[model samples]
Target: MKPRRKSVPVRVGNVVIGGAAEIVVQSMTKADTRDVKATLNEIARLKDANCRIVRVAVPTREAAVAMVEIKKASPLPIIADIHYDAPLALMALEAGVDGLRLNPGNIKDPEKVKEITRRAKEREVPIRIGVNAGSLPGRPKEGAGVRPPTEEVVAAMVNAALGHIHILESLDFNLIKVSMKASDPPTMIAANRAIADQISYPLHLGVTEAGPPRTGAVKSAVGIGVLLEEGIGDTIRVSLAGDSVDEVEVAYGIVNALAEKLTGPNLIACPMCGRLEIDMLPMVAEVEKALKKIKRPINVSVMGCVVNGPGEGQHADIGIAGGKKEDEQKLAS
Candidate 1:
């Protein structure tokens, strides 16, 4: 991987983002934030799945009030996701949330943003200027095509982030992170690259509303993996519409696939072809299950045929290949 983008480090609870810290993996809880029990339960599962940071949506007054209890019980650092309502952000900071995510799209008042920044600065809590393509600050320009030029979209996202960054920086409050997410990968990649060129604040990467697990993982992998390979992102989240734990798993998968710093065992399996000589699917599944207990990074390959087995599995730390017969299998060392 290319050297990571140089970013000012921001601490969220115990986890440090940017500056020489490992690419952090994070996910948002899907449960209603008002249901403290359910939210806590989801966080426990996310922690088990190796999520380093967790974001909880504080959309309602009750939810904002519940932040106190959830933050108290959450094992991972809790970041309150705020939109529209500035008081909700205040409520979260007062409840001792580790961090805050303010959507510039909906919460347009500069005075309110400054108020939250003052309180967050006093508490030393970091805030993420989370800009989403779907919720940009203004309506599309007149006489625009079906899709605006990529440059226009990219500029919009970056400018939105910079606007928020300006508000926080004005108060000498530099505990900041930024995210420019879009449901589409191209826009997300372009926006992040643009912002990365202009700012030193840590960036949280994701392809927002990236559909179900299968498709979302692919979209996130493409968008996040491309940036990570270029060393453009400081942290990442895979926004799958499924279980929150799957988001953590997919986030790690994207990181592991692109970067050398793996969080868990990396499983390499070949797509079964007609040349296959053994039932490698079951074996791959079994190996994946066994690798879950491992905490360290290792490459383990399971190939289904001899044609590419020797060549493909040769570099892996451990590998298994099917032989001519079902009972015969060879281990590559």
Candidate 2:
């Protein structure tokens, strides 16, 4: 892996992001934020999945108010996502949320942004300038008329984020993180690369609206993994349409696959081939199910056939080599 990008450190509750801190795994609660009980339950599940930071949508005044209870109950640091409504941002801060995710494109009024920044600074709460391709402010008619869609999107995301950062900076507030996301992996990558070149703030990576588990995981892996490999991302969220717990699982998978952070079992299994003398499919599945319960970092290998199985098994913390003998299997450590 390449050296990680250098970024200014910002604290969210007890978790520190950027600087020397390990890349954080973040997820949003899927339950209605107004239903404090339901939101707390979902956050508990995410916390179990090793989610270090959690964001909850604050779409209504009731939901913003409920953040007080949710913040009290959540194990992970809570970030309130506010869009279009600066007042909700203030309410979330007043509710004592650990952080805020504000979409500059949606909330464009400078005065309102200044007020939010002032309140956030007074409370020492960090804010994330989250810019999404789908919600970019419309292009100004005074600007150039034509550009490639990718260029236009990337430029818009970076500009919107910088604009918000400037607003906060003008208020002498600097505890900030930024995320420029798009469903398209290439667009997300391009926008982040552009922003990384210009800013020192920690970046939160994600592929927004990335579909269900299988496809969303792949998209997030490509977009987020690419940035992480290049040392560009400081934190990540795997945005999926399914349960938020799945998002945490996938986010960890991406981070782990990069060898950036190892949270659980690292399984190495062989794809069955004609050389196999015994059925190892069921055994591998069973081993996987059991490994999930073990939190300590360990590598487990399940290989079929004797050709390379013994050597591979010997290298793992615990492993099984099938077909070592006609009726016996070899287990090694």
Candidate 3:
């Protein structure tokens, strides 16, 4: 990968994003934020899965109030996801959240944003200006050819982000991060590439509203992976529609695949052919399950037959190869 783009480091709790920091992995809670107990439980699970930061939706006053308790017990830094309502963002800041994610498309009142920014500056909290393709300011209603072209969409995303970024900068508040997300991979990639060239603020990358795990992972990998390969992302959230833990795992996988810094165990398995002498599927599954408990970056390989097992897995940290008999497999480390 090329050298990472220079950025001003923004601290989210104990974790530092950008400015030579390793790529951070973030996820949002699926549970309702008003359910403090349930939200805390989900955060705990996310931490166990190696999520570095967690975002909770604060759509109502009750959810904003719950941030106080959630932030107190969360193992990961807490980010309140706020949209449309600016007061809830203020409530979350007062409740002492480490960070806030505000959608500039919906919350367009400059005075309202300035008020929230002033409070954030006082508390030294970072605000992520999240721009989504579906909610651009003054976006046209759904109709034939009503949706803007790809170039228009990309420009709008970047413009929205820059507008909010300028707002924060006007207050001399540099604790800022930005994200321009679209459900389509090409649009998402183009918008981020455009904004990355224009700003030094740390970027939070994602493909918004990506479908279920199976297809969502692929979409996220394509969009996020392309940006990371160009050294343009600071933090990433894989927006899979399934369990949030899967989102964390996918984010780490993308980081591990591109950057020199690795977050979790890496697994390598070979495709079985007619020469295969062992049940490779079950063996690969078993090794994958065991690898999850490991936090460090280690490569493990599982091979089906001796024909090319040793050669293929020679560089792995650990290698397992099958002999003609199931009992004759050999392990090398």
Candidate 4:
């Protein structure tokens, strides 16, 4: 991994983002924010999945008000995601949320933005200028003109984020983070790279609307993993269509695969080929199930044949290699 981009640290409740902190994993609650019981239940599940921070939608006054109760019950820091309505942002801040995500493209009034920034600054709450490609302010009419170049998309996203960053900076508020996301992986990666070069604020990474669990995980892993490996991302969220807990799991998987963060056991298994002398699939499955219960970070391998099996297996802390027969199984420690 390359050296991480230097960024000013921002604190969201107890979790610190950027500035030497390990890249943070965040996920959103899928339940209606107005339903405090449902939201809190999802928050608990995300926490158990090792989500470092959680964001909940604040679309209405009722949802904003409910944040007070939800924040009190949530184990992870609660960031209220507000869009279009500036009053909801105020209400969320008044509700004592740990952080706020304000989409400048939707809430365009500078005065309203300043008001929210002032309140968040007073409360020492960091605000994220979340710019989504689907919601770019003053976007060109689709049918009225020729299609714009792809670079325009990246430029527009970065400019939108900087515009919001300017709003907070003009208020003398420096506690900030930024995210410029698009469903397209290349666009998301390019926009973040542009913003990382222009600003020192922490960046929250994601591939917005990245589809179902399988495809979303792959998209997020590529988008976030590439930026993280380049040392550009400070935190990340894997946007999946299923349970939000799966998003947290996928986020950790990306970070783990990059070897940036190690939270659990690392499993290594060889693909079965004609050289295999044993049924490797079931054995590997059983080993994986048992390893998941162990929290200690260790490398465990299950190899099928002797050619590369013994060599790779012996390198792991605990390993099993197959021989000519089932009784000839070799264990390495």
For each candidate in the order shown, give its overall lDDT on alpha carbons: 0.89, 0.88, 0.90, 0.87
Model 1 Cα lDDT, one tens digit per residue, 52-126: 999999999999999999999999999999999999999999999999999999998999999999999999999
Question: What stretches of model 3 exceed 4 Å from their correct place?
Answer: 140-148, 327-333
Q: How well does each candidate superpose onto the true structure, as a TM-score? A: 0.94, 0.92, 0.95, 0.92
What's the alpha carbon RMSD for model 1? 2.0
Q: What is the Cα-based lDDT of residue 310 in candidate 4?
A: 74
TM-score of 4: 0.92
**Residue range 92-195, candidate 4, lDDT tens digits:** 88888999998867998989999999999899999999999889966654555544455888888888888888989998999999998988788899889888
Q: Candidate 4 lDDT (Cα, whole model)?
A: 0.87
Give the Å error, residue 254, model 2.
1.4
List per-candidate RMSD values in Å.
Answer: 2.0, 3.3, 1.8, 2.6
For TM-score, candidate 3 versus 4, the one ahead is 3
State in Å the error of residue 254, model 3: 1.0
Model 4 residue-pair collision total: 0
Q: List the candidate numbers ranked by TM-score, top first.
A: 3, 1, 2, 4
Candidate 3: residue pairs that collide:
none
